[model samples]
Target: MTRLKQLRFEVFGVFFRQCTVDHARQLGLVGWVRNTEHDTVVGVAQGPEAGIADMRHWLREVGSPQSSIASAQFDETDIAELEHESFGVRRR
Candidate 1:
């Protein structure tokens, strides 16, 4: 079954959101990422379990080369249906 994950990325530099969108697209995951007013990056990603896991790992360990990720929080939801057709960067 497809898995859905809501992720919040706390990053210490710029361009994390763009990197996130790129990574998600490359991973073939669907979701939307945006920069929060609180200086955090947030998004929801849904796809195969393995892709979700890879995204989680990337959020934690390997964000944009210009970004220093402070932390990543992931919440797995009961949703099994795809919510988005592609990954995108949402405007604040």
Candidate 2:
């Protein structure tokens, strides 16, 4: 449970921002999600092992509302440490 981790997902359409917000809150994760200019949404979540797992589950099950998710890609990474702040949508 000490391994570093990170998640990157893409949601196509206009339903990403809102859905991500709710999902992150439900999972008790702390990170930020934002929309790309290419019509895709991207996000990053970092925290305890259990919390991150819950977040992944939510995204996989119901992360988008008005948008039809074309695909999702995620992987683990070596982060120095988790951030000390609230998680929410970020302007990009």
What are the per-residue Cα lDDT tens digits for candidate 2 across 9-70?
A: 66555466877877777766678889899887788887767767777766666566566666
Candidate 2 has a TM-score of 0.75
TM-score of 1: 0.83
Clashing pairs in 2: none
Window of ten residues with lowest summed lDDT in model 2: 5-14
Model 1 CA deviation exceeding 4 Å by range: 1-14
Q: How many residue pairs clash in each candidate?
A: 0, 0
Query: Which regions of candidate 2 fall more than 4 Å away from where they truly are?
Result: 1-4, 78-80
Worst 10 residues of 1 by lDDT: 6-15
lDDT score of residue 84 within candidate 2 = 40
Indicate the residue-level lDDT of 68 in model 1.
71
Q: Estimate the TM-score of every prediction.
A: 0.83, 0.75
